[model samples]
Target: MPSKKSARLAALTVAAVCSAASTVVLTAPAHADSVRIHDIQGSTRISPYAGKQVTDVAGIVTGVRTYGSSRGFWIQDPQADDSPLTSEAIFVYTNSTPKGVAVGDAVTVSGTVQEYVPGGANTGNQSITEITKPTFTVVSSGNAVPAAKVIDAKSVPAVYSPQGDTAAGGSVNGLTLEPTKYALDYYESLEGENVQVADTRVVGATDPYSELWVTVKPWEHRNRRGGTVYGSYDSQNTGRIQIQSLGKTADFPVANVGDVLEGATSGPLDYNQFGGYTLVANRIGTLKSSGLQRETTQKQSRGELAVATYNVENLDPSDATFAEHASAIVNNLQSPDIVSLEEIQDNNGATNDGTTAADQTVQKLIDAIVAAGGPTYDWRSIDPVDKADGGEPGGNIRQVFLFNPQRVSFTDRAGGDATTAAGVTKVGGKAALTVSPGRIDPANAAFANSRKPLAGEFVFRGKTVFVIANHLNSKGGDQGLTAQFQPPARSSEVQRHAQVTALHAFVKDILDTQKNADVIALGDINDFEFSDTVKILEGDGALWSAIKSLPKSERYSYVYQGNAQTLDQILISPSIRRSCDFEYDSVHVNAEFNDQISDHDPQVLRFRP
Candidate 1:
């Protein structure tokens, strides 16, 4: 088993995948299958809530119970204490970008509620909500803030990770920060006048609170309607960034802390909220102009280069050519700005020698990137591989990644395949998780291993793209090969559907943001263009099969018993299709390259913001 820290990262990395998208609109109030609305004002809605049915909403999110992504997020109308007229909110993204948003952002969601009462906001036990989908639209748009930096808060206690104390520590770039105490594991605090921030800054309207009883933090990021929206600060929420007597707080001014040092908006930043020290700005400041720049995650990038993905067969690194493979990878393809590696295994019970898959794979990939001779890349892999129930005695499969330093910055990682981690599930697909690989009976809770997907963001030619790299149920003719016509029915299908569910959740998150979201869902989906999973994903038309831009004659990624099937694929949010440069290269698998190393091939797509 991997260390708890890595395991925590994995869960946080792939945490929010889950939902049942509502396609039908019902006039009846008894069910939330869909709600009919002809807004009194101009209305916008992405079908199935940007491809997800159940979503969390703030403002007046009613009809609370359990809902969304197997309860990874939920909604509630818990009566307030009655001192203030606090409205209800729906937690649409329990797993995706948890801390980016604040407590009071107004949003409207469409999804079912839950059977259980959630523990607290950061406990990770919101409830299981599946058939989930929702989008964020700005009834009111708030200022933007950086993602992982710290904003000094005197009264603000240290922030902590969801599982333990202090999510972030000290020093990044040129600035240093105090470790996060325990304000909220996944949320930014707005309770006091000064708000700690890093990464991105808030850009919104200003407020006029002369009496100054209204202390605040920036709002949370949420997905609403057809457009993406963030929280704002008004009388209801923090209206805008304003000035005040920020009380003296603890200072750890080495990283992006200490408010506007070196003429920057808290410069010298660290990416993770957990590892670095951060500072609170003592004086009022403008949202930093040049700390980190991401147009928006999941939104398409602006460029001519095509983006692609592949399963690389069982990307298991062996000793014989572990060095050789690394050399070849860097020499041949070099390091992709962001590449997703799947079917990766890590030691489960110390059975597989003392060496583990996670470490081995990261080292090899990083080594290869170094050999390739560009800027060496940073690699991140899931800690506790999502254990497939009863499968393989001790091998755990995980999706891993490598990032090119010169090309992009590693923004954040979310949601992965670990069962022990909080707010995670196998409801979408039913593969049971095991300490090892192979099969277990369908009855147990599974951290089913599919092609592990990685979610984060990167800037490609100034345009930011939020990417979800997936290697779905293999098209090896064995993974759900028996039920190609249906969405996986057996445990195998469960694993397949789990991948699908996760992908859908990803789509939901992307759509929840901006109008022109650049989303790419690529990898060995296992299902072809017409398969159940593919069809379901493309159903509402919110997503476009990026491969469709390529001629059908060239769509196949793998050969199944000699039949041409598109095992590898990409799906782009509709917002990015017309402007995206989507393409694929079968050259690797063609008569020219060795097609036998892995059954699947690679595909790419490009976007121009």
Candidate 2:
């Protein structure tokens, strides 16, 4: 019969990679047809004895997850084979209580072998090889559980994946695992087993879901804020892993970057659909602060312009995060002269009305900025047609600019409207925008359902600086890192590449007429600094990404899945780069917090205009 614990402990069936450990010896009946759990787990990604009937399987019950749809108990063979490439423990799926079996009970079970996916086969989730419809007899109770194996810095490999086949364009999979060399192999080696990681550091913010990520090795790819910089494939970041307290244990604590887990954390490793491989801990350690403080940019001096890009993350009047955002801008970013804001929703956010104007919303933000002791800023943007620009349905999220009138002046020409496209025009022997606040290629198909680029001219210290605020296509449809495809498809970049191409053509037009035009294209580019989209925007060094000027470890304005990465960027023309006095700061306020005002932290760039 199904026990009450079955519903909550259903998650215990999720398992991960394999590893070797000292096995415990227990007395068991010498059945002629007994099978070992390691023999069924095998050495490959799939089980060797899957879908077959095993009459007698004996092991000590290390874990009892009696609740949830995946109600089962994990059994570890006391006498295990000496193979680092195979796990010793396997989950026995009973779908209900197995009568009197409990943790530390040495039981012999008979059941049919199965490969069960948590959400079933259609979800592309990995399958856990288990014994279902089990009938188990307890030989003894109150016996000691298997010793928890320790996985420290030396235990994990520095490489991410094995080299993929040449025909598959370097996609990794279907290869023999050498756990001593590759990190993925090492984790795979310990799948479905209890293990411990001691003296680890939390590398990512504890998410709203009460889960945090930790790096077993805190010295590799370390960021300024103590997060790990997710470099390209060459910089194998092997020590990062997700941590969760299975319902069987106490709630996992919410933590930030640089927090330390004192002593040892013991748990069973699980590979699930949400995060690839996670350590679901049954025992947690004390969390300590690492003295990490939030960073602020160096103040801009006289004759210098502080330009910034912030994605307010669907900011609307109804959203209660306005005051927090205003405080971040005024206090954290130090009130940049010109700020490019993305994801600004219409007056009634998500109401789905015919209204496309955001005048009230912008005015409220300006009032909040002044209330927060910031500059009296003026804003400009050409609102998009209702429901045309992509974002939250009926929210009409678009990009806009906030410039301090005392520090800079908007160079208004004439004739800019919601649908009218802007062009580069020659005014008095200098490159000038035809319309002061206008859209760049509003009618282009590349920007369909995406925020169009808002280009505007500003005069800072008597020098004209053209700025383009953009919110390109997001990384929505891309395949996940743990996707079934070896090298998961980055199909979302195709649209972003086209969008940047259009922006590049517009900037090229201005640079063609005036070779040394001061053009600053900045916003949530939604692409990485090394991405092809940024490459197309740079176009042989015509414009350089200022974030690249920062140290490789500090070049991120966003963090996702324990990887410190960059999604917001500031790319300045050669004129700004030649000045060589540019200061770029990824003001880290929001991204690394459990109660984040927005998903993305802002980027600030200060230079002589």
Which candidate number has the best lDDT?
2
Over 436-547, each residue of candidate 2 has an lDDT whose tens digit, in order, gives 7999998889999989999999998889999999999999776556543455668889889899889999999999879899999999998889888899999977788999
Task: List candidate 2 segments past 4 Å from native.
Answer: 1-34, 50-57, 64-73, 91-102, 105-141, 165-173, 247-250, 353-355, 413-418
lDDT per model vs. reference: 0.37, 0.80
Query: Where's the lowest-lDDT run of ten residues in candidate 1?
Result: 37-46
RMSD of each: 26.7, 6.6
lDDT, candidate 1, 1-609, per-residue tens: 334344334322222343333222313223234332211000111122222233323232211212222222222222222211111222343434333223322334444332121222122221212223333332322422222223433433433222212221211101111223433211222111122342322221111211011112323221111011211111111211222221232221211111122232322111111111222233333432223211111312334434546454344445343444454345434334666665555633324453345676567656755665644767665454334422234545555656666666654434333432212123224211121211112222322444345554555666666666555565332311111111122334556765565557546644654545666666657666655677666656657676666554445554321124555677887767765444434433321112134445555554553
Q: What is the lDDT of residue 408 in candidate 2?
A: 96
Candidate 1 whole-model C-alpha lDDT, 0 to 1: 0.37
User: What C-alpha lDDT does candidate 2 achieve relative to the native structure?
Assistant: 0.80
Best TM-score among the predictions, by candidate number: 2
Lowest-sum lDDT 10-residue window in model 2: 17-26
